[model samples]
Target: MKYLGIDFGIKRVGLAVSDETGKMVFPLKTIHRSTRENLFLELLNIVEQKGIEAIVLGLPLRPDGEKSLTCRQAENFMHSLGRRTSLPIYTVNEAYTSLEAEEILSGKGIRGKKQKESLDQAAAMIILESFLECIPYERGLK
Candidate 1:
């Protein structure tokens, strides 16, 4: 099944998608957030177009696994999103996703403007890839 992963941030929202086989994950696009309603509408359109069967949201948590004000904000966003779609929504601990993305880009020689532009989407890709890796274990746990 295809999946959509969201790296929701205050300024930009990053999106990533998995192939129909659910094995390969890739950065899709970054949505510049001007308004909350518009962000939701954009997500709805992408979900429809991508045939996303599920959503994995990157829940930004503290190193100690505590939810901060930002995390609470994201929770509210997720709840609002739940009302819009029947697809299963899941959250993954996304503590250092952005840092990892930065490191990955730097290793590949991406810097400055290019790195900044691609960072969020790369983080979303990491979030989605992490979620996909846990699927088998998650299913077994079920």
Candidate 2:
């Protein structure tokens, strides 16, 4: 089943998608949040257009695994998204995904504004990859 991975932020949201086999993932794009309603509408459109079967959303937890304000925000986003779509939604703890993303960008020599623009997308990829590792493709089929 194809899956959509999301790294939610207050200002910008990152998206990634898995192939039909769910073995490979790729960064899709980042959506700039203008309004909550518009963000949901755009996400819904992507869900339909991509034929996404499930959603994996990054839950931003503190390094110590405590829920922060951002974590609560992510939870709210998850609930709101669940209400909008019938697909199953899953959450992965996104503790250092952003830092990891930054490292990746730095290695690729993507710096400054350009790196900032792509940081979320890379984070989304990491979040999706983490989920994929936890549940292998064959296991996910059942």
Candidate 3:
């Protein structure tokens, strides 16, 4: 089954996807929060086109491993997304995924604000990849 991964943020949401085998994850796009309604429509289109069966959302938690205001916000967003799609939604702890993305990009010589924007999508890719690694492929099938 194919899966969509969301890295939710205040200003943008990064997207990543897994292949049919659910073994490979790839960065897809970033949707600006200001245009999220449109973003949802676009994502719906992708779901239909790609035969997506599930969604994996990155749940941001505080450093102490507690849910924060930001985590609540992400939860609300996930609930809304669930209402809009028939696919099953799942969450994974996403602490420091963005920092990891930044480090990876920096090592590759990427710099500045532009790199930060790309990091958003990169982080989503990392989140999805990790989530994919943890779950057995057979379990993903409904």
Q: What is the C-alpha RMSD of each candidate to the true structure, in Å?
A: 1.6, 2.1, 2.8
Report, for every candidate in turn, its global Cα lDDT versus the true structure: 0.93, 0.94, 0.87
lDDT of 2: 0.94
> Sort by lDDT, best first: what order?
2, 1, 3
Which stretches in model 2 have alpha-carbon errors above 4 Å? 137-142
Q: Candidate 2 on 42-63: residue-level lDDT in tens?
A: 9999999999999999998887
Candidate 1 lDDT by residue in tens digits, 1-142 = 9999999899998899999999999889999999999999999999999899999999999988899887888899999999999999999988899999999999999999999899989999999999999988979953
- In candidate 2, the residue pairs with backbone N, CA or C atoms under 3 Å apart (3 or more residues apart, or in different chains) clash, namely none
Question: What TM-score do all the candidates reach, one by one?
Answer: 0.96, 0.94, 0.89
Give the per-residue lDDT of model 3 (tens digit) for 27-50. Answer: 888888667687778878988887
lDDT for position 135 in model 1: 86
Using TM-score as the measure, the top candidate is 1
Where is model 3 poorest over a 10-residue stretch in terms of lDDT?
A: 133-142
Model 2 Cα displacement at 103 (Å)? 0.3
Where does model 3 exceed 4 Å of error?
A: 137-142
Highest-lDDT candidate: 2
**Ten-residue stretch with the least lDDT total in model 1:** 133-142
